[model samples]
Target: MPLFDTHCHLDDPRFADDRAAVIERAIAAGVERMTTIGCADTPDAVGRALDIAKAAPERITATVGVHPHDASKLDDALFAALEAAAHDPLVVAIGETGLDYHYDHSPRPAQQAALRRQIALARAVGKPLVIHTRSAPEDTLAILRDERARDVGGIIHCFSEDAPFAKAALDLGFVSSFSGIATFRSAEAVREAARALPSDAILVETDAPYLAPIPHRGRRNEPAYVEHTAALLARERGEAREAFDAATFANALRVYGLA
Candidate 1:
């Protein structure tokens, strides 16, 4: 059952009190690696994961860029800092960035502009983009096409349940990632997409602190829960969990350039 979480927000305040304990618990649960994203507060005040990665440099990995809700924070100061900080080896990806029309948290234009800038920076820095798209798939893909994001390459993070959208993204050479949504009773399409990916094309994320799986539905998710989704995916493919995990983890590492 050894596996990787692929995505999480150990920085979120919920983990602040016993974050180390949580990581230890996950490790004991056989979760091997986790990506701590850059979509946090101001660069200086990012939470424990980045702080730990900075101090230890290997226990966790991280990405750079602002989340849509925080797009306004991608101002010059944050942009400049992200550019400088992204060079760190601990940082392997450049986003969690993209459009989020569901919440319409930030102005759509602002999210679009930030997405473009982060894409450019990711290309310049030679890191994979950690994309986050929701309810704005058309424009999200549109912007990526317009910005020529294929040159940089990245994942369609926490992918939409729509396989037509999955096919469209895969056609662009982007990896499709599934989160716990795949385990939802109502997410047959998402589950099927996970099963249908061609060899070396699928990845899974917890989107942790959110979207926990069936047994833990509506609960706060963490990296260890990735295995549950992995189990379901493996079952769908009629393969053993370990082999499926190996393939999916390899796909994620390849996508994020962890190798």
Candidate 2:
């Protein structure tokens, strides 16, 4: 079955030395397409993400937006850069942006402001969004609704919320994406959340260099291992692995506007 890693950070420094090899492995493992997120963790992350997509245009695409952690840095210059990046041919969406109250790396207010701006950017650009909400579901949902995000739709990347949150996002035309977290013993609730969503609203990712699935847990992640999460998600949803994989792949394409 062909797979699609709907969200990943291929621009992360961990893959700098051998990014090409990583892509090869993903393709070998049946991942046909991958969307590399351009979360503005650093000032130049968005540009770097587009560079990575340019390196392998046929199999990769990118998104451009500031991440919640970097919310404080979303200055006028950065917003201008992001707006310009949004028009890049390789850019498929606008974000990896949203609220992250867990770390509070950037204050809550800043994250919310950044999220609203990015939501507007996504709508203005006529592209979808790639949201990163954590520990702030209520605020996230409020902002999404307030910003009328349903107009462009998007994916709630690396989702870990329960059914109610999934329902809320689904109501806004957003889909829930699963990551290696879905394979964790402690992530039973996450799997349940995956089960709760309709098949077409499900997408999978590795969020690589981060949450690698079991058997490779605690180790660095990469796109090839998305299959493990896909396997778990398929079983939890009581669907065939091949069908689940194909459906999620198509879901990613549809959300990213590639379909």
Candidate 3:
């Protein structure tokens, strides 16, 4: 079955020299669709993501928002640009937003404020959200609840939280996206959580140019490597690879409103 990489950053500078080759490789590897995210870390990040998606509209889509790392930089002008990017036919979601206390690149309050604003934008634009939370589950869940994120739904991208947290997110109508981290031998906890989640509430991503899966563990990641992560997740869930692929592809389309 064909595969889908639900989250990645094709606009990362690491992909600059061979962006086309990377996309082509992903397609050849049976990665039927990809969603490249624009965290608005830099001035041109959103445009870069859109251009990549536009280059292959049928097989790729893009998202726009400010990352928690850049939370302090977010302002009216930036949000306006993000909202404008969301209007593009190729734009399918409203983030890579949420709290990231592990890095603490931005202040905690700034991260919270940025997350809330993006959640509101997601609701306002009627699009699903793509969240990133690390070392801040309580605050993440609380803010999500307070902001009524359940109404619009979204994915907990690269989920690393425990089972109860995953359950809480599921209860709030969010899907958990497993990344290459789930394939790591050290990630038994993550695998257990993936195994415990409802099949329909699960998804897979690469978070590429970041967490490269086992075997490729020390190398740079790209969309084509998502198959490796998906394969491992399929095995952990005890579903046939084909079945898992179809389910995740459907779940992704549904969550992103592309179905």
Candidate 4:
């Protein structure tokens, strides 16, 4: 089955020692393509993901933005760098940017400001967005609306919200990309949301180096493990695994404008 891990952090320190091996494993496991997010907290580091993508352009693409956790660092210089990087041919999207109230790593105001700016950046560059929202659904949706993010659309990476949130996001032109969290027993709301979404509005990801799925729940995650999340979604929706995989792969391509 072909798969697309629509989100991951291939540049993360965890993958530093074996990034090539990890990509090899993903391809061996049927991940045909993956998007490595470029979340720079500093201006100088903005090109990290682009460098990775450039090395394997056919199999990898990248998104550039400052993560919500480091929203405070998105100053004029970094934003300028992000704007320049956003125009790179290998860059398919403009974020992993949005609100993260769970950590409040940056203040709520800063997160919101960063999200608004990135949404505008996405519109400016004619690329979709890669939103990372957690525990701030109302505010997240409000900001997206206020910023007119629907103009460029995007993916809600690692969707942890419910059906209503999914529906709301879809209305704003954002598709929900489910991650390993969907496979957890306690994530009933996520499962329900997965079941309820239209096939085209749903995509799957590993969000690797983080939410590894069941049976591999406690282990370090990589692109190869995205299949477990896809399997869980297929079973939840009572769809054939092959069909689900194909649909999600195509959805990722469509959302990223790769198709």
- Cα RMSD to the true fold for all candidates: 1.6, 1.0, 1.0, 0.6
Give the alpha carbon lDDT tens digit for every residue of 103-177 in model 4.
999999999999999998999999999999999999999998998999999999999999999999999999999
| Residue lDDT tens for model 2, 1-259 | 8999988999898998999999999999999999899977655655988998898899999999998999999998899899989988789999899998999999988999999999999999999999999999999999999999999999999998888999899999899999998888988788878988888899999999899999799999999999899998888888988899889988988888888
In Å, residue 29's CA in model 3 sits off its true spot by: 0.9
lDDT of 1: 0.81
- How do all models score by TM-score? 0.94, 0.98, 0.98, 0.99
For each candidate, what is the lDDT? 0.81, 0.91, 0.91, 0.94
Which whole-number lDDT from 0 to 100 does residue 226 have in model 3?
A: 93
Q: How many backbone clashes does candidate 3 have?
A: 0
Over 162-248, each residue of candidate 1 has an lDDT whose tens digit, in order, gives 877777777766788888888888888887777677868788888888899889998888887887888888898898778888888
Q: Is candidate 2 or candidate 4 better by lDDT?
A: 4
Q: lDDT (0-100) at residue 35 of candidate 3? A: 97
Clashing pairs in 4: none
Q: What is the lDDT of residue 49 in candidate 2?
A: 86
Cand. 3 TM to true fold: 0.98
lDDT of 4 at 238: 99
Q: lDDT (0-100) at residue 240 of candidate 1? A: 79
